[model samples]
Target: MGEENKIILHGTWASLFSKRVELALKVKGIPYEYVEEDLSNKSPLLLKYNPIHKKVPVLVHNGKPVSESLVILEYIDETWKIGSLILPEDPHERAGVRFWANFIDQHVLLSVAKIWKSTGEEQEKAQEEVLEKMRILEEGMKSTNLEICANDLGLLQILLLTTFGSFKAYEEVLGVKVLVQENTPLLYSCVTSLNELPVVKEICPPHDKLVALLNIYRQNAFKSTTN
Candidate 1:
């Protein structure tokens, strides 16, 4: 492919959404240039690529920009049909993958934010919500034979992997065990397996770095609450 048609990804290392796109590209073995965005002072390139949302995880392919992590994932799957497919061939299985991906974005992610941003009664409520959501997710996984989606790694797996990886930071900051081995064995197993993947191990941010960032966020949240 010509240089103009090559893929370029704009994203931040810490962003779960960005990580999802990164994982997708890595899984598909697509070679792309990675541009890390400083969210505090975003680059002009990021703005040029994603003017509306102006967010990370923008996939620029063939000089065309594709925003939104899930949208980029589907685009990658459709564009590169080699390697492991991110969506199943069957329409129903594809829908299931989409459903779980949406669930992680709409429900699981929102609850995780609440857990870390709030305190006291509000934080406790958010914790309950996260646990409830995890239960539902675990049940969904159980029904689907414990695979992330269908029989192979797909969009849902990428989404959930990033979400759960971020949850490790939140769990430490909030002092809660969201994905316990005893309570959610299958989900825990899924997390373990996903982490062990070579691509994921190489690309996913280090756990200690995530925890340090979360600690800073926790301190700031406390300071704001006190103020």
Candidate 2:
């Protein structure tokens, strides 16, 4: 909030990664300016801030740019040092949070992307990976005390919030249930808990709109695969 700590987040409305950064900033009661960027156009400022990725959810604090959503989440927690810490104080617990967050992004989201982006054998493989990863995450939650509490806002919780938030849209688009309650009750419970929170609700995109967007993206992805 101070002049020396002016924070700006560059992101797009429909970007899950962008939503992660916005959710973190809002949860911490941190004041920041939001700048929405068109990924298609790739603004020069976005390019300058994050040349390697040239992506959104770039947090610029004190004029310094921080790229990558997971990295930015921890950065937010570390820098503020007030309110409830999003990352746990215990190093081991913190490590677990980071590990699972990465797993969700890399294994879960990436595989889910392939489901809608690819077809035939590749898409079938992705669907299997999605289920397997979900099982792993459910077991991971059961092994630990991690749950999606709005007040806590831990790294894993925040990441799951963004990922699970998109499940409905993905399901509607792909005609498959990725986060099934029968198979992964613990993970399903986390999704339910996340939805109960007002912060999570506010952060979630319009469900119908998201489904339409996913369908459009799916069509485009399918087209690319064929061509």
Which structure among the candidates has the greatest TM-score?
2
Q: For candidate 1, write residues 33-141 as lDDT tens digits.
A: 9988898899998999899999988999988999998899899999998889888888878887788778888897788777767777888898889878888988886
In order of appearance, the predictions have TM-scores of 0.90, 0.92
List, in order, the clash count of every candidate structure: 0, 0
Model 2 local distance difference test score = 0.83
Residue 219 alpha-carbon offset, candidate 2, angstroms: 1.2
Residue 78 of model 1, lDDT score:
95
Candidate 2: the clashing residue pairs are none
Residue 168 of candidate 2: its Cα lDDT? 76
The lowest-lDDT stretch of 10 consecutive residues in candidate 1 is 144-153
Best candidate, lDDT-wise? 2
Q: Write the per-residue lDDT of candidate 2 for residues 103-167, one digit (tens) a residue.
A: 89878888887888866787778888899989998788668766544446777777777877678
The window of 10 residues in a row where model 2 has the poorest summed lDDT is 145-154
